[model samples]
Target: MQLVAPLNSSLRRVPPGWVYLAGLIPLAWVIWLTVSGGIGIDPVKEIEHRLGKIALWFLIGGLAITPLRRIAGLNLIRYRRAVGLIAFFYIVLHMLAWIILDMGLLWEQAVRDLIKRSYLYFGMTGAVLLLPLALTSNNASVRRLGRNWRRLHWLVYPAVGFGVLHYLWQMKVITPEGWLWAGVFAGLMALRFRPFRG
Candidate 1:
């Protein structure tokens, strides 16, 4: 525990590696379980679900940085890009899983799901928005676009909304857990206003 404290300070200054490391452990664990047959039933769906949730959690966590730093006095800004990129990466995986595993690369099925299922459409919309953000995240693109890059990145808020809506719409019963996620996202969105953050 003492060792981790110092590590945490170092991570705060340069957190991309740490963020990847932090996320990799759970991702690797999931892969391991799937390979080892420890996941019991429907391993593919279980893995897909877990990855998607983790991705969404990262997205929310990335969004929470500004509020946490302002309200809670945590310097979470350094990790924001890493968190966002990882969130994008995981969402890509989740999308691929749906496309290849669930839809089996069937264009008709994918189109049908997007058109018919509100949840899928929401998720797909969120994923689509992330593409531009991810592409322009690097130093080169940042320099190339200047202020325009920031404008594009601000789309994250709506993307997050789409993600949360996707989760809520996916759940048949709208459990307390789903409500909690939505509530947190609501709080995050609200915090964007100075009055609320203060």
Candidate 2:
């Protein structure tokens, strides 16, 4: 408690806007990789993958906020909204990169690919679910929706699960790193439901 006291104290000085600014770092890195020719031969795919991965990381961060407070007494509620919005931004970019760079804006081809690439359905589902949450992630919506806002945000759990599935399905075989992410999500969900009351 004493250790986290100082940590939480420092966090109090940091504004949520700083979190939003820091979220841009991942996008900047991707851009750097692109200019430096370090994004692989398939740059579009690389960009798409990197964006999706970063989005997942932010989503995980958003999901971790409550559990971190509950299990470790570390409060990060102030930045959860920024984290969630950044995640949605990255997801939108990922989809756009795929549509424009990968599919070249060919609607018919994109539709064909969307139908053939079954794993995309998971990502699409997650993105669709996130849409409403993102649109309503404001004070006015919070006031208007009241209790329903919390219920609507609960969609994040399934959306994240589907996002993980989308990620895992992209791999030829689920690597240990991939399994670690899935395990982390599962652990967070467990802690959420059976939080320590001590």
Candidate 3:
């Protein structure tokens, strides 16, 4: 195993709230751009791109919990719920953009696109999967669901796969950046299997 770089003694002792606050940098930047007209009024591509990126970031965040906790020795358990909820937040916004801006709430056309477009179908599946996971994220649900909570959350892995595939299929040329994230995802997922788990 690789040695984890030690955080500052201060950082190791910081409160969980501060850890979450530290994680808000990217979200804050996105919001600033959205509000400052830097992203523009009719910025469909920019908006969609940012939404997809943020969704992927959240997906990475959710996936990182176990690795960070176990491998990095980072005590990331507290961040799991926060990271998961943030993922749900980005996903809801992504869906809202598609429904409100792209499709204009056109149910017939949306249904047609879902049926005809494989990438769109993959994206829709990812979004739909997020709903139940988001709903059951609370402490009450966790207490009630017990071990089954984890079983249900396993859907996030496939959701991430579908999300990346949705993007990769849509891209005219899959860039190094795309491949890098996919590689990271593959490594993370590989860790979940028996051989790599060691």
User: Candidate 2, which segments miss by more than 4 Å at Cα?
Assistant: 195-198
Q: Which model is ahead, 1 or 3, in terms of lDDT? A: 1
lDDT of 3 at 160: 86
lDDT string for model 3 (1-198, tens) is 233434534355667677557556766777788788888767766777788788888888789889776766766676677777777777777777777778889999878867777888888888788788989988899999999999999999998888888878778899999899889889899888888664
Rank all candidate structures by their lDDT, best first, as comma-separated numbers. 2, 1, 3
lDDT of 1 at 46: 82
Please, what are the lDDT tens digits per residue for candidate 2 over residues 1-198?
Answer: 779989999999999999999999999999999999999999998999999999999999999998788768899999999999999999999999999999999999999998998999999999999999999999999999999999999999999999999999888899999999999998877876634434
Query: Which sections of candidate 3 miss by over 4 Å?
Result: 1-28, 40-42
| Distance from true location, Cα of 149 in model 2, Å | 0.6
- lDDT per residue as tens, model 1, 37-121: 9976987688778889989989999999888767656666778898999999889888887888888899998898788887988
Candidate 2: C-alpha lDDT: 0.94
Candidate 1 clashing pairs, residues 3+ apart or interchain: none
TM-score of each: 0.90, 0.96, 0.84
